[model samples]
Target: MQIDVLIDVKTTLGEGPLWDVQEQRLYWIDSVDGRVFRATADGSEIRAWQVPQKIGSMALRKNGGAIVALARGVHFLDLNTGDVELINDPEPNLKNNRLNDGKVDASGRFLFGSMDTLEDGPNGALYRLDADLTVHKLQDGIVVSNGPCWSPDGKTFYFSDTWSGEIWAYDYDVEMGSISNRRVFAVLQGENFRSSDGSTVDEEGGLWNAQVYEGKLVRYAPDGTIDRAIPMPVKNVTSVMFGGENLDTLFVTSMARPPLSRFPTDSVQGGSVFKITGLGVRGLPEHRFAG
Candidate 1:
């Protein structure tokens, strides 16, 4: 499959890639730039919203609008009226931390995580936002919390602490809103320094995860074995989500960090969002936040 640059804009840290199946538009956030973007399927008619703070992620609400995450807290963003309602702040004490990757589950609950401000140390944690608007901290002792995704069956949950270079799977109880039997599902083996950034599952239960600094996308089977690898044009591949009309198109987002002395020349393609075509597998539709 050929990875095409759907959006040419450079971002300091472009992470989330959300597909609006209803409007056939692609949405994503630039973490460091404090911006969210919306664009047509063909990359035209793009619009941007300047968030007040660095946004980790966002989820579409069932009623319209979105559930937004930032360092301060999760807020119900009413785009229609330009209003932001505070859902809850999970980390009021951890001022050095900021919210990171997040997504709503199949049952309409939001799963989100936080990252340490310095980008190091085990100061991050993961939280789940229930349909009733209750916030629950699921796990602690994390660094750069990301890739909060669930299996197609909702029986397993996958997450990662980017600083650790390991993606973990949890035996999930979707109905109970709990996870257990945590274990490694995928590991990046190398001395060059790279870790799992973001992920999405295919219809066939394959986990497609981006290996940051490695410049590749790794697809792991349900058995936790390497299924395939696709090389990217940049060194900082951030996240990927399956979108498009048939859910067969894969939209990948990336980042271009400040002068990393080693990979100095790849900054051009690092921050652009890409679209991959010809993938035989389709993806599950995104779940909307119930609240």
Candidate 2:
């Protein structure tokens, strides 16, 4: 595998990274600073704007701009002007909670979850937002909600609760956008491994996950078996996504300064984005938010 550094920003808490296919650019957020950054493919030009609140994740919209998940609620973000238009606040009463991770499903629905900011309790929940702006609660009692993706055929759904140290899979309904039969898909086992962070699916339906404190990306077969382990330069590999023209490129994002004083490896470029090519595999295009 060939790894190349895309951006050496070293954001305080670089959590979300989305590839804008139309503009051929990458957009990511630093949650701690509430700043969103846009960069060229080659990292030649970079621009940033401060959002209204802490941005945990975002999805590219089919219409334009991005659907942003923040501490308050979901909103529409204008990439050019950094303007935020509120869509809806799913959890207006939960003052101590915030939306953490989310993605658009095949049926043009948004699936996201909320996490407890204190990180001391199982207070998070997973929810689905339809194209008509209707919201449905799917799962609950999560600590750090993350890594929501689907299979190539949209028949399987995968998600991760970082604090659980495990990943779960469910039988997905394409038309209804529902999931059932939740089972263990993979368990992150290792003394160095802390939790499973963000993930992506390859063309062959292999699940690729970034383990936070492990400093590695574990790609698993559909049968919950280990396929391979790709080591990372940094410990906190936040998220991974498929980008590039043909989706042959795997874009990995990381964190530089976490609250923990310890690290799994001595990586100097901890808060940078990386691209992995020559893996002899490709990833499916990211599903966009239809609304």
lDDT of each: 0.87, 0.85
The candidate scoring highest on lDDT is 1
Off by over 4 Å in 1: 258-265
Candidate 2 per-residue lDDT over residues 1-291, each given as its tens digit: 798889898887787777777778777888777888888767768999898898788888888888888888888889878899998888899898898888888878999989898776888889898888888989998988999999999999999889787899999998998889999999887676569888889989999998887788889998989999998877778988877777778888888787455545447888898889888888887778988
Q: What is residue 112's positional error in candidate 2, in angstroms? A: 0.7
Each prediction's TM-score against the native?
Answer: 0.95, 0.95
Give the lDDT of residue 254 in candidate 2: 88
Error of 2 at 275 (Å): 1.4
Q: Once model 1 is optimally superposed onto the true structure by TM-score, how far is the C-alpha of residue 64 displaced, in angstroms? A: 0.6
In model 1, which range of ten residues has the least summed lDDT?
Answer: 258-267
- Checking candidate 1 for backbone clashes, the offending pairs are none
Pairs that collide in candidate 2 are none
